[model samples]
Target: MTPRPYLDITPTQLATLAPGTRLIDVREPDEFTGPLGHLPGAELVPLGTLEATLGGWARQAPLLLICRSGGRSEQAARMLARSGFRHLYNLAGGMLAVRATPVAQPQG
Candidate 1:
């Protein structure tokens, strides 16, 4: 087994995600669109079903995982890293931090 790589990123750092960056929210559906709105272009892939749903995703694509708190997303990042997916990052402080800062808008 290889070492797990963990990368922590912030909202300000993500102000300009490079093209093809997959910003994913590992929170539940309700939480995604609830009081704490999700990132501009974050895809809803709740952690519970993430493994099963990731079967066809591009393993090499840049992925930014997020959750209500940083814990769950960190878990997801580790999982992907173990599965041979690199370019993984967890949103530092998660949505709670996002709520405190203006987030990046989706790029065209």
Candidate 2:
């Protein structure tokens, strides 16, 4: 299978996602909600649950994978790519990096 393109983006790039793009948070629910709220519109699909969730995802649009740092998301991105997700993106430094950027705060 052809490898999908993984776009590495910063928090600023969130605004650039087109309407159909999928934002997936690979962190556990606790981690997502603990101290750092999730990105608005991001679907909470932890890494362990990605495969099951993939059945319902849109293969056409890019899947933006995010985690605490970038590791888990990158793994998730690769897993999805192997499952034939044509477009994938890894948040360069995850949510922490995104939060550090000067962007509009996301409402929980």
CA lDDT of every candidate: 0.89, 0.84
| Candidate 1, residue 9: how far the Cα is off, in Å | 0.5
Regions of candidate 2 where Cα sits further than 4 Å from its true position: 1-4, 104-108
**Which candidate achieves the best TM-score against the true structure?**
1
**Per-residue CA lDDT of candidate 1, range 1-108, in tens?**
965586898877885667889998999999999998998888999998999999998888999999987999999999898887889989989999888887468999
In model 1, the runs with Cα more than 4 Å from the true position are 1-4, 102-108
TM-score of 1: 0.87
List TM-scores for all candidates, in order. 0.87, 0.85
Residue 94 shift from truth in candidate 1, angstroms: 0.5
- Give the per-residue lDDT of model 2 (tens digit) for 4-85: 4577888888778777777899999999897877888888999998898789777777888999988999999888877888
